[model samples]
Target chain A: MKNWLSPRSTAGIVLIAAALVALPFVLATGGQAWVRIANFAILYVFLALGLNIVVGFAGLLDLGYIAFYAVGAYAWALLASPHFGIHWPVWAILPLGAGLACIAGVLLGSPTLKLRGDYLAIVTLGFGEIVRIFMNNLNAPVNITNGPQGITLIDPVSIAGFRFSGSSEILGVTLSGPQKYYFLLVALAILVIIVNLRLQHSRIGRAWQAIREDEIAAKAVGIDTRNLKLLAFAMGASFGGIAGGIFAAMQGFVSPESFSLIESIMILAMVVLGGMGHIPGVILGAVLLSILPEALRYGVAPVQKLLFGQILVDPESLRMLIFGLALVLVMRFKPAGLWPSPERKRELQPEKAGG
Target chain B: MAETLLAATAVAKHFGGVKALRDVSLTIRSGEVYGLIGPNGAGKTTFFNCLTGLYVPDGGGFEFAGAPLVADAPQQAAARGIARTFQNIRLFGNMTALENVMVGRHVRTRAGVIGAMLQTAATRAEEAAIRQKAIDLLHYVRIEDRADDLARNLSYGDQRRLEIARALATEPKLLCLDEPAAGMNATETEALRDLIDGIRRDGTTVLLIEHDVKLVMGLCDRVAVLDYGALVIEDVPAVVQKDPRVIEAYLGA
Candidate 1:
């Protein structure tokens, strides 16, 4: 136990945990805006880390990942919200949402198992669009998704009679809804990190890496690549589902617009920009990409007003331009990503010595 | 006579109009070094692919240890105790030499996702055992010092031997080596012959596809000659060398 928790790592863990635990209180003066942004950043970390399993570990390109997110959110909303009239407990529906998302993942993964690379990407992209369109049009036929108007009045998360959506005083400290959700999200994210780390060192993880390197060789060594790929898809989708459940409970709303193609691309970007297979790198990517836009949202307008004496480009537009430029620069300078795993670093080496 | 460990009967494969393998039948006795030799495009590699289930044979079936073989994928074949190397060397290039052999130990190891995630006692013990076995295999191949290096970084001879070490990690009853001495110097070829001898002595049947005539003639107890997707002759190396059909198949009668 002592060896596992070396002093330096123990110190680092304590420092990080304390900082995270104190963040909501520290941002109290800044209002809920900062806390909400942090919430979203952590949410994206869930998304990017989940996607790393498929794209980074399994080496499957899935552009329809947002479809799973939508499935999860809707699963939570339809079960716990006013639209469905079910009012299931948040805990009960969360796992169901994740399971539904896993099924969706497997369904999407099966047909595309034979497709490689870009073809797989296109199919997943279509699957994502199809889900979004289904959500948009389902109201007329069955009112299943409540269509474009979206599902509203989703129930807040409650565990053992303690409501997370409503404010409560803990040790004389009043916690707001977002702050409470923030703690829960942090716990969930930590769980994800642990799971991801364990998986990366496992036999399945090694087989996935071998498949990524050479499918034929992986098969030769007796790895069931087809089932493993589906497992990757399902596992990754489950995390997306959990995040979506949290998103629905916190926001009390779900809509087709929230699960758009751009959201999927943004999640993929987070995975690629951070460092594809590395867990820490993916979290870093997710946090940076999530918060950077908000930072740009506030900084760009003022900078533009000061530099140009007029609004040359809106902050949103500037954010896109800078984001594109950053991706390009990163690709050119550090294709392995900001914090590439040693394996990924070797894989992306410009010129391998052996040819 | 030793029991026939592997008996492939009239195996056939074709690609559109081109027959890659046709009517190829051979039996490998337990604990014997069996050689499959042929010219370019003689379907030696294709035959290996069929046995390993990379390609489904159009006809014929196999019996291993008197049990009808039903494996239809490489993984299944490996699981059933038949491991193979590639003619072009298909080592997982990015993985370390030890890791490559560890992957070869996949069929023998049984730590699934849950066990791996929890790092249970069984999983840990299995993984440690696999690592030790891989290291031992590397040592057997005389490349234990290069075990930590990436497979692609190893020298050509070491890489070829590494492939053998990897195949041996499956604890296979029968090891199929595709041109194990390919691109090796005469000295390296001699070393590979000794290695095959050692493998057979260790109770594994050795089935090899080699283009090196001298190495095959020197090392094989019995050799099978393939020409134009068909087996022309199978006999002792001395008898095979003198056969008119073998001579004609090699020199084009």
Candidate 2:
């Protein structure tokens, strides 16, 4: 039991969790703004982590990952809100969103299985645009998503008649804005970490890496390359779905603009910047991209006024510039990612030009 | 001990109008090194492709350890205790030597990615044991010191040796070498001979394809000469050397 917690990983989890948990308390003076940023960042970590499975571990570049995210958010909104008047709980919506996302993943990945490599990426990118446009255009006569304006005033989660909404205190804990969101995001991040770890270590993981390293070699060994790739795609998409569900609940709104192609690129950049197939790196990548912009939003203005005398940068522009430069620098230097999969790195080195 | 470690019976493969393999059949026994020797266009590599399930055979059957074979892919073959080195050393170049070997053990290792990431006791113990095994394998293939170096940095001989180690990482019962001595100096070839003998001594059944007749003859317990995808002769080195059919096929009658 004790040994399962390898000091390094255990310590890492402990440190990160402690830091995240303590951040809200430490930064409590400023209207709990950092917690909101943390929530946003953690949610993104989940998205990036999911994409890492599809893009990094499975070696399938998915530019349409945001579609699943949208699916999840919409699914959550429709279920939790008065849209249907069912008012499903967050726990219930989470799995439902994930299941829908998995199905969506299969739908997107199925026909493209035979395409291979960059072709799959382009197809997925098209799929993302398709999903967003579909959401935008789908609300004609019935008003399913409230059209381009999106479904608003979604209900907060209720568990066993215990509702977490409009500042409720449960078990002596004051649950308010970004608090439940942060908790939910943390839980999801942990779950993703665990699941991705399991997937990578299992027989399936080896098959994925084999395909990545050498498709011919993998086939020669009797691996079902097509099915395995599909499984990876679906599995990765499910995580995106879960994150989307939480996103809907946190904001109490759903909009087509939210899940754009830029969102997909941002997620991809997060995965790449952190390191492909490295869970910790993926997590880090997510938190950085998602939270960094939010932090810069409020902080950058004051810093600019203080340091430069004249305001030279806004939060959005500076954030974008920094992230873009970070991506460029990462690609220039650490192409394999921040923390690469050691075993994967090994399997390919023997024959690839340098190996 | 088990009749033969591997057996391909009347195997046939075709690419478009051209026939790559034409009803080729051969038996490979335990601890015995069977050499597949043939000239270009004789379908030597095609036979390998068929056997390993890279190119599924169009007709006929191949069996491993008395089990009927299917279009079993390479990773499946690796799982089923069959390992092979490629003709052109296909190592993961960006990875270090140790990592390359570790990947070979990937199928053999039961620990999942989580276990590796978390460094769980079960995973850690298993990983350590595997690391040791990889080290031993490197030592066996005579590339122990190069374990930390990137695979791309290895010399030709060391790269070949690393491939051997990677194959051994699968803990394979039957090891196939596709031109193990392909681009080697005589000394390296001699070293490979020792390595093959060592592997055989350690109880692995080896099936090798070689262009160098002398190396094939010197190393093989039995030689199966292929002429245009047909087994022209199967005998000991001396007997194969004396066979008129094999000579005629090679000498063009």
Candidate 3:
């Protein structure tokens, strides 16, 4: 506790909080697009943190994690959109989406409990594809999901009568839809971070790490490895669910294209690149990965034109090439990650530690 | 005579065509160091795994503390007051030495996901107690100074000791150690002997599997020798050591 509340850390916390609160306005000065990107970045933060629970903490490679996100988004779309002629409150729907995603998580996890490494990854990959396909095709039979056209006019998150979709002036400052969504996402991310921190330091966290280190050893020590693994899946999926719900409300839409395999892989890359099992590192990874592409999208074309008088490659293609190169270089140099957990750093580089 | 603590009846296990153990039985009384010794492929470790629920024996059952012990899983075996250390030193390598032991207390502690996430007062107290107890177990194994070190970074002998410390953290009625001194030097083996002696004196029955005949002959109150998955002999160490069948099994008659 004393270590946690040190003056330096307290000051750091206050500074970060101030920056987070001011970020939207700062981005809005540049352009509203930046704030939108920031909102997505926060959403990615939720996905990365949630995946970290499964892949980082429990050592379970989950490649179909975005399925839970799909589940949550569809839950919101079905409950609050005109497609179903049903409208549920944000609070009511978010929990339901999270609950449904958790059940989906358990369903996906139970069959793959006996697998490890590549096998588990393959199974999860299949699960993610299955969910996306279900969403894509479910429309044909019952007019559900709108068949890739997506459900529109979804209700924005509202409390009492104040809608997030509309601008509101508070304390001489006006908050736009994206800005309001940004605050909501940040608040939720903070809550998720707190939950991750608590779980990391508690018995459940220790058990997960133990299982990650050696499942047989963990079982020998009296840990119910099967149940704990399922718990990891459920917990991680619920976070993804919550993020998906918020994403649906923010976008006012839902589509199968939005929950693709690439998205799951990208979220996984964020967890791995930022630092698996480390909260700050994961958040950093999420923000960087989510924002970097947009930054490249906007910056690449102009910079190419200025330097070479013409673009050598399309900005979109160039952005991806640079992104791939950066990932490769980071992996080659860092091996563990950009901000690896101390234990993982030591585990991956035993020779340097003289162990 | 002390009360019987564990009894194995006609335990049998086979893998395809290879018969690992066949109809081997043994009894261990409370408060004694029991040793199991045999030649290579004699099924000593197999028997240990079967008892500890790492493997399900095709035939046989165990009576622990006068109850039918059906441990289909390792956690069930642990919850039934049986704890064990692996022959290959399977400590949670990335975790701190103390944390490795705290994990052993998982069966004893009652905090679930909600309790942990909430950090209820009782959960906090239990967590603290678990930590203190783990530290104590490390001290008992003389690795208290290495409590904060990652289990993987410790010296080989210290890692073995840490495994012992972790097993002891379960507060088991019976503790089993498989080849604990496998890679130890002479001095380390002597220290391990003292640690096992200390554990037995602390009122936990010990079941040890060892290849070190001298150590087994010296430390065990009673020893059992297995030859080709059959019981060669079971008696006081002095008697078993002199038995011709045991000699034949070891030197090949």
Candidate 4:
């Protein structure tokens, strides 16, 4: 049964997850604050893996992807939070959020898919802005989102009379705070990776890559390129939705600032930096990018404090510099990506490796 | 008489005021190489495009394998086992020789996006088998050693052969080759002739569009000569050599 997950990947993920679950307990002994960073990093991993399918495999650059995340967060926020006075189960909200995001995905992709490459990118960028502005200005006549004030006091998920409120203790362990979120996000990341890997080896996956590689050749071979692009858009958005729903429940709040254009760029960076078309690369990219800022935040603030007696380089400023440099250097040195696809690696070093 | 694998009956095509092909009609037979030969501005490529549904004919219908083969779209032509190579090589440049072939095998596999993402056991089994089949086609075309090479990196002769391999991976009942011997040396041309002969031996009917008169005359068993967007003659190679119209159109007699 375990063999089905992936030969070595299943074993690696299980061992890693088990180690991680035991780790925070060990790390909590020293700095409990590190657990929050860990949790959010895993969350980023899930988002990265999903976005990889669109930009990496399908070769469709999506700048408005964060809108799906917003949709998912809002879906959960409107449902579980007392702002609406409606408490839907987590199980129900997850699918509902994904489905809503998928619908939004199809709506966005159906028309814009005809536009290729850079034009498509610009359109999606506009879309992300449009969604954010729409959400921000929805307080025209009747107030819905409270006009940029945002929704708050979202309830935590509960399973079978077990409200995972910030106060529940189980088996001498709590299911709230950053620790539980870390474990849950890791599981979600693994799920996303498995799905991506499986898709890469499957026929539809090949078709998407084919369409990505050469639209004319793919069309000549009888693939309906339009429908395939739409599928990538919707499926990729569904992951963003799932991640957003999880974010809403974990934060116990929903705000416009959380889903921004920068968030979309950050996710794209993860897919490219990690190596497009490689699931492990995307996950690694997600973790590296998400954790880099915080780890540097801890390291840089101290150095700045020692030199100038004040914090000079903050995490936000450093992230932008590093992100820009990384894109340029990475694309130049390794155009395929850090962890390039097996197919790409073979093509790159035919005499040395492909045999 | 056979109804023919490909029949373009009273086919007419026009772009605005100019007529590209007027009332072009021809019947293509199975187990033989049918040549469409014409000088520049003679609409040979245009006629080939019409046959493959690249350009929808303004007038007339086509019949292939005793069923209606409408000149509506490329996908329709592909679905009916009509596979073609372009005049300019259009293989996925970044993709490996093997992947170029695998894309050709795509229509045969019916796995959907979700089924692919999940790898539903069936997709896995199908992937392995098809991958092997692509490798086999490369081997058959004498380029198995370069299966992992990027298509653009190949020598011109090998690129043409690789294109053929990719088209063959589609499992076409009838293969349409446009200028298969356009830029090849004597040795490569002979190898291509052997390869085309072998492809016919494997039971695939070939429709060849070539500019090389010697290669065309040597390879084709029965030639369908196209001149000025019309079928000039349909005869055995020797008979066509003796025909005045074939000589007048191409050799400038």
| TM-score of each candidate structure, all chains considered together | 0.97, 0.85, 0.98, 0.91
Quick one: ranking by TM-score, best first?
3, 1, 4, 2
TM-score of chain A of each: 0.97, 0.91, 0.97, 0.90
Q: For candidate 2, write residues A2-87 as lDDT tens digits.
A: 56589887888789779877776565556766677777888888888889888888789899999999999999988878776868
Q: What are the per-residue Cα lDDT tens digits for candidate 1 across A1-355?
A: 2455898988998999999999988886798888889999999999898999999888899999999989989999999977968999876899999999999999999999888899999999999999999999999867899999999999889888899876799999999888998999999898888888888877788888888878898888888889999999999999989989989888899999999999999999999999998998999999999999999998888888899888888888888899999999998998988998887787666434443
Evaluation by lDDT, superior candidate among 2 and 4 = 4
Roughly what TM-score does model 2 have, to 2 decimal places? 0.85
Ranking by DockQ: 3, 1, 4, 2
Which residue pairs collide, candidate 4?
A199-B117
Question: DockQ for all models, in order?
Answer: 0.67, 0.25, 0.68, 0.48
* Tens-place lDDT digits, model 4, residues A286-346: 8888988887777777888899999877867986787788789988998878887777666
Candidate 2: where is the Cα deviation over 4 Å?
Answer: A1-18, A26-28, A32-34, A140-146, A160-162, A169-175, A194-207, A221-224, A299-326, A333-355, B1-5, B79-81, B96-98, B106-136, B171-173, B248-253
Please provide, for model 3 over B26-116, each residue's C-alpha lDDT reduced to its tens digit, 9 standing for 90 to 100: 9999999999999989999999889988899999989899997875688988998999999888989889899999998999998887887
Q: How do the residues A63-152 of candidate 3 rate in per-residue lDDT, one tens digit apiece?
A: 999999999999998999888899999889999999999999999999999999999999999999999999988877678778778889
Pairs of colliding residues, candidate 1? A222-B75
Per-residue C-alpha lDDT of model 1 across residues B16-53, encoded as one tens digit per residue: 99998989998888888899988899999998888988
lDDT of 3 at A346: 79
What does the lDDT read for residue A71 in candidate 3?
95
The candidate maximizing TM-score is 3
Q: Per-residue lDDT of B1-253 in model 4, one digit per residue for the tens?
A: 5337888898888889878787888888887887778887677778878878778898887898989876656766777888888888777766778888888888777778666666678877788888999999999999999987787778888889888998888788889999998888889899999999899999999999998888888888778777777778888889988889978998678
